[model samples]
Target: MLRSLDVLLLIFLLVTAIGVVCTKDLLGAAIIFSAYSFTMAIVWQQLGAPDLALTEAAVGAGVTTVLFLIAISRTVRREDE
Candidate 1:
């Protein structure tokens, strides 16, 4: 049962990763990336690595997402053709 949950999380992570890459909107991509990072943190926690999970939450989901949002806000929203 636990292993199945882990597998589900992995699948979610993969989907979020693809969403991040495939989305044309920068803000949407950043949000999806944050979701990906959060899923990774959950996986790390489930794998018995609280420290790694905390790091991922702080760095990947927290700092990186904030930075991406800030950068996106500072720049234009639409992709240039």
Candidate 2:
């Protein structure tokens, strides 16, 4: 069961990473990146590194995502102009 979960999480991480890269919209990419970071945090926890997991979750998923979103929000889209 644990092995299966690990595989599932790995797949999810790959998919989210691809999604982030393939997305044309900055907002979509930021959201997908956050998902990827969150999955990485879970992977770290599974590897028995709780400190790393916490840092990844806090910095990668939380602060980084928020910063990306804020930057995206402040930008003017060419289509809108």
Instruction: Please name the candidate that would achieve the greatest TM-score relative to the true structure.
Output: 1
Residues 1-81, candidate 2: write the lDDT tens digits: 578888999999999999987888777889899999999999999889999999999999999999988888898422234
TM-score for all predictions? 0.91, 0.87
* Per-residue error (Å), model 2, residue 57: 0.6
How many backbone clashes are present in model 1? 0
Q: Report residue 5 deviation for candidate 1 (angstroms).
A: 0.3
lDDT of 1 by residue, 1-81 (tens): 579999999999999999988988889999999999999999999999999999999999999999999988999665452
Cα TM-score of candidate 1: 0.91
lDDT of each prediction vs. the true structure?
A: 0.93, 0.89
Q: Please report, as a residue range, the 10-residue window in candidate 2 with the lowest summed lDDT.
A: 72-81
lDDT winner: 1
Global local distance difference test of model 2 = 0.89
